[model samples]
Target chain A: MWKWLHPYAKGEATYRLLGAWLPWLAGSALVTLTVGLVWGMLFAPSDYQQGDSYRIIFIHVPSAMFSMGAYTAMAITALIALVWQIRTAEWAIAAIAPVGAVLTFIALFTGAVWGKPMWGTWWEWDARLTSQLILLFLYIGVLALYYAFTDARTGAKAASVLALVGVVNVPIIHFSVYWWNSLHQGATITKFEKPSMAPEMLIPLLISILGFALLTGALVCQRLRNEILKQEIHRPWVHAQLGVAEQER
Target chain B: MAFDSWYDFIDMGGYGFYVWLAYGVTLLALTILVMHGLRTRKQLQQQAVQQQQRQQRLARRKQQERGTA
Candidate 1:
């Protein structure tokens, strides 16, 4: 399996792969986000209990959910790099960290803002909120560790170890509401049997989620290409790629 | 659709501050992130081109020195 996948792990191959997919991701993100946000803000009916405040769910829930998803994704890339010694996967770790960190920040900030009206406070120490805060710290910690060493390869390994350990927190973040008494609401969209939201409310939320996921994908691909160029700048393939870019310019 | 008029939608049933703030902050953060990533890539690509051009100049100079010798 390693041998077969090894060729595609090279920097040039990965660069081409990302370039090919960038347009599709960007287009989908734009379309889905426009439709979803418009539908959410103007079309979806207000919740009986929360009224218009519930509309924040469209942005808040997607960022909150994707932050966890991004962390899990970064960790999986780290694991692949560790186990298979793939350099592209290592670059992917760096590419994903900042994006995940920002998503986590958005989630935390939006949650706090939403909390003021809903919970009557800007902050809390509930298990879910605390765990989510810790998740943000975990992302910053990985990025910090990755850049700490002057030698990037060593830093990548160090960061990969941290990401793997942080994987424990991902599951903790997901189940914290279930495992303890918390002010944060329980899972709504992920409840397979029946989502707590009405279909009109749920559809826009789901669309926003898809839009956010595509946006994440587009950002990661852009970063990954940048990383590859930075690391592979001296390679012949990189020079050839640059030659084409120069001509096109 | 839920609002009776434009003012009512903006009023958000008296929760406009909380809802708008959340959406606004999220949009601002995401925009900042994407822009930063793009700017970094642009800088790196420009640097790569400059470095390549410098290396080529040095190689050409060395060849001329060899020919003179």
Candidate 2:
């Protein structure tokens, strides 16, 4: 039943797998982001009311969405690492947290900027804004817990627990707009109902989201690889691997 | 292409500051992240080299002490 999981249990195997993925993800992210930004900025039809100001949605929505998604991913990885004692998963969780936190901050900052001209205020304690703010706090909490302990393994465990506890807020953040009468408008590109956007506008948005997701994956893999190398520095295989990398370079 | 002049592009129909700032900041952040990653990887490589040299020195010192004994 768990046969497939056995291969990745080894740090070397995990490192190799991530190394294979990083380049592909990085390439795809670059291509997709370029296409998305150029298309959205130049070709997409302007919003009837907001005009070109609405173009910020391309980056704003994707970053916001991925911020949430990355947190959820981190939480799940934390749970796996804790329950299964999987070191690779532990490294992955740590590697992902900072990136997720940055994305969350980006989302919040961009949201505030987008809100000012449209909503007549930079920010409000509305459902979406408030929940996003809470998300930022959760990210900070995980990061703070990560460094609070001296022992690496103990720190990872404590942070994992914190991440799991924070998982409860994910759904609340996702549903905040629906749960409250907020000044922030509800989901536009994310809804299951008919998309309220034209193809010209929607295409760039979808592309940007995909690009952001890929970029996140690339960053996570790079960070995870670094973590694995750091932890395995004393292992003979690590030195040999470094030697090979040096020769290749 | 849509804009008639530089001012029109900058105007963004009066939402210029918000729109451009959002894009500008996002790009700036991404650039910083990439540069940071590269710098960190270089730092890690240097640290690894220093650690290897320290280990080699320790081994040589142990050999010298054994010879004197």
What local distance difference test score does each model get?
0.89, 0.85
lDDT of 2 by residue, A1-249 (tens): 579889887889998899899999999999999999888877787888888889889998999998999999999999998999998888887788878877888888888889899888988988788888888888888878877888988988998999999988889888888899988777786556888888889999999999999999998888888888888877766666665233211
- Per-candidate DockQ vs. reference: 0.71, 0.53
By lDDT, the best candidate is 1
lDDT of 1: 0.89
Which residues of candidate 1, in runs, are more than 4 Å off? A1-4, A243-249
- TM-score of model 2 vs. true structure: 0.93
Q: Candidate 1 clash total?
A: 0
Question: lDDT at B68 for candidate 2?
Answer: 100
Docking class of 1: medium
Clashing pairs in 2: none
Error of 1 at B27 (Å): 0.8
Candidate 1 residue A5 C-alpha distance from true site, Å: 2.6
RMSD in order of candidates: 2.1, 2.7
